[model samples]
Target: MARIPTAELSRYLLSGQINRQGCLRLRRTPFLPRRPPCHNIRPLSTTTPPTSPAVVVVPLRKQLKDQAKALKSSGSSPRKKKKNSDNQTVPGWELTVGIEIHAQLNTSRKLFSPALVPESSLEEKPNTHVSPFDLAIPGSQPLFQPDTLIPAVRAALALNCEIEPVSYFDRKHYFHWDQPAGYQITQFYHPFARHGKIVLYSRDGIAAEDGDRIEVGIQQVQMEQDTAKTLAQPGGVNWLDFNRVGVPLIEIITRPEIHHPATAAALVRKVQMLLGAVDACTSGLEAGGLRADVNVSVRRPGEDKKLGQRTEIKNLSSFKAVEDAIIAERDRQIAVLEAGGTVAGETRGWSLGGTETRRLRGKEGEVDYRYMPDPDLGAVVIGKDLVEFLGRSMGVLPDEEVEGLMGRYGLTAKDAMALMLLDEGGRVEYFYEVLGELEGRLGGEGKGEGSYALLAANWCLHELGKLTEGEDAEPRTGLVTEFVAAGDLAAILYHLHRRKITAKTAKALLWGVFNCEVAPGGVTDAIERGGLWFQELSEEEYAMLADKVVEGEEGVLAEFLRFKQGKSKGYPQGKLMFLVGKMMKMGPEQNLDPASVKRVLGERIEGVYLPQLEGEEK
Candidate 1:
């Protein structure tokens, strides 16, 4: 007989026959009560149940081809329809959501073992900062630095979590090309901090509203080690960055209670604030060291339909990406189910280039996260005193900063909030200092809130806002703060509040600060030293003559009569103050005050508003 080829023979072996009568006909599938058969294929084991938790393995070549052929014959098999997550469909399907946020702890050294460098000084290079522990060589051991725990704990407390008196670590085994260390040291099941929370606000700045005030619950925040990153190149070979290996990571989780994508976005933003509040990490999204892996599922409204298998969107890395991925995934699933198909459980990646999410298949129930206590590192025992200390010292909370602007100063809620929120680091504090000085110097008993400081807030926040973003952004974050400090702000405010300089001229003065030969001076100097003066000088002088006027057409003394009425003719109180500002520039130092111009103006006006001498109160 002709020699049977391996491919042909293999087919015969499965079919139990070899024939070529045009096309060999194979027997139809046989069914047995003992086997839970599916898709025209018999189970590999005789007594397997359809709902059993055991892995489903079909006979390699035969099962795959048969399923494909059957599907093709029917055009396509019907897929299971997906329900809404909140179970808030038209029937009000509720969408139950929980999230897992993986933020790399900001540390001078890596986790598991010291490896990562101060990302500040060095450019990110593959394996450049790798230590022996990162390499996973034989005889390699692990270590944990105490400093890493502080920042991580601080951030958790800022998230409003209560630190557990005792929380520990475990090793989770999962094999990946990049993780040649065989297993990863992780904290699973139980984390260091539990029941933490994240808060979100309304777009309108209203704390309470329909789509605002989202609060997501915390499952637990765990500390773990990060795996090295792989950068895939065009070729099959991948470039590796081991420098990040063993980096300490904090895993923050949430309850599956959030119903909307907007809520997910809000939760991430809250975490950013929490990080900043603790001063543990920069609240920047574009940079690494912060990443959130979002867990999502869908269900139809009112169905109580079991949560659709959750699909994890991995490495979202940014708040914007988190929002975008949730939306994209929601829409993608809706489209599939609307077309009558089921969504398989899997992991996904957010494509920065495409702004989309792509699926990653799940082959097993779990990676078996083969968890065991970390051998190299010991348990962390948190003390009550240390927790208290960190909480007090934890950095600024955005909301509290806003409140400070309102209560401590005379700013309107809007302006004060804008100032602090616009610039957090050192800038808001500096503004508050200058505003305080202005208040002390002005000597107004500061009655009636929401009028003056609010105005200052508007000016300060507006200027700082212009500096940070938009196409017309500033090159310096502190540049405005510095200018505000040198008392130039004082001079400008003096003029503005005194009504001496028009509001329009006040802005012009600031613009001048941005690009003049002055290299950015304070508000006061900008007015004093600048050759550009917004007011007309002689007109001011002409008004001053009222103090000198003979009260009878002492036209020659008309100038003095005008002066008797304080500064000039037809000038607003603000204009007179600008004249005084001029005086200060022209007069000796320490003999000057902006408000004094006001007092002097009011007194002279009273002196000149005198009896006509022709005898008339008229």
Candidate 2:
């Protein structure tokens, strides 16, 4: 017999053959050494031998290849599935999301140390705010701060969470350069609050339709310490700033009830508003004061009880990032399941501009953390009376303020939400101050009921918001509140309300007040000094002015006629406004109300100009 090569013999061994005993067995060449049997590799069939003497066992790899070949022969490719659109969820799949928000408490001192918290973390020099306890000095003991508990409890109450009478801290053991201590102390076994709910509305600056309401549940609110700020250098070196170390943080964990990305962002915004309302956490994401970690998962629509494996996108800094990351992660998991792959539970990080998340590390279980009660800290206990007192002392929350604005002033839901969410607490105050002045000055004489309040809100939110919006798009309501006093703004709005000044003149007067060109509470004096009063022309005088503008600008009149006859591409209303603008410019010293001018000019174009042009053409 010819000797078989080693490779040929191994191939034959993988493809078993029938022996003389009528059993499948590996065939070895005579020149090759005998190999030990693999007891783990069982036969595919253990039945009695068939009538045929030959038997062959196909390997798993060969079976897969044969199936792939069959698919190719059938003119189908394994990689040709339909792709999903960006905004559409995968068909037959449902997404579930939860967020963990870490908001730095507005406290002057550290949680367990006496280090003074920096007022501005970015402006303060590094290493200057660190305390001996914050650096993990051997003998320093953890002291609980009572003042920090006030804001924490207030936040819990604002979220409608049930306050825990007693809570304890546990040490989560981890090794990292940012944490000088070997373990982090946090509320693990018992959080301070639980079972809260945040009601999100469509008008809450989210992506829901009108009248849509979603209630997201709060799992728990636990107090924890913030880690040090880690700044990485260009050359693999790292700098640790301990200013943030031991800073008080409240980790707000929400239940996996959210189904949409925009809802998750709205929940975060509601929390920010509530916290700011209660004077708890004034710092926002830009200042490293608030951070959100989103957990996203997807499963088939019928699998209500069973959730797919979730991956957490950590440390999202903005509300938009929170929304986009959840969306990207949801799409990613859906694609994995569709492509016949499993989604592993892992931690992920999102790049600022990237569309997908990158794996940070494998998900750590409770055993990995090696959690134990902190020996240095004792249980925290709160009395029922203190909770009641803090609840009573809490300021008007976002929801209450929104409701009040809508009920009292008849403001729309969108307008009410906008007022509450602007510049923390200052925008609302300025609005009320302006309303008060308007109420005193106008006394509901020229406007409808609650119209003064409406006027005040619109000017504060629209005009002032636009004027104060600098390069970064954040409204400098503080600067507006500082320079443009409520009385000054109210004075200008008062003149506009009484028809003494046109809207254009009112806006110019506001700009003067905002830029400090007008003296405080001297809007009347400025209007008098500049003779900025509305020129109230009678109907006859207005028609004369309108005719003067139309006859002088024959080209504009022809265009207006063309537009009116549907032969032009421009807006007839715009052309009419152009005529009104020309007429207004003719009397620059007298502030003309554009509304009156437009009305008069529109009548001339329709009642007089169009008939003349049509008759001339005929």
lDDT of each: 0.61, 0.79
In model 2, the runs with Cα more than 4 Å from the true position are 1-88, 206-211, 303-305, 444-446, 468-478, 549-589, 601-618
lDDT tens per residue, model 2, 1-618: 444344443233322332433233456788987787543332122232375232344443455568667778888645643323235355688888989999999899889988888887555776678766787765568998878898899999999999999999999999876787878889988999999999888777555431377788999999999988765433443455677889999999999988777778888888998888888894766446789999999999776578889899999877767877888899899889889999999999985534678999999889999999999988899999999999989867788889899998989998888888776667888899888888888874856757677878889889886666656344443456777888899898888888899777888888788777898878999988998777687888888877877776767778877887789887766666777677988755364567788887877888998798888989
Write the residue-wise lDDT of candidate 1 on 326-345 in tens digits.
76687677666668998778
Pick the TM-score winner: 2
Tell me the deviation in Å of residue 380 in model 1. 1.5
TM-score, each model?
Answer: 0.65, 0.78
The C-alpha stretches of model 1 lying farther than 4 A from their native spots are: 1-92, 121-126, 199-214, 232-237, 353-356, 363-367, 406-427, 440-449, 467-491, 519-523, 531-618
Query: What global local distance difference test value does model 2 have?
Result: 0.79
Task: For candidate 1, report its TM-score.
Answer: 0.65
Instruction: Score candidate 1 by lDDT.
Output: 0.61
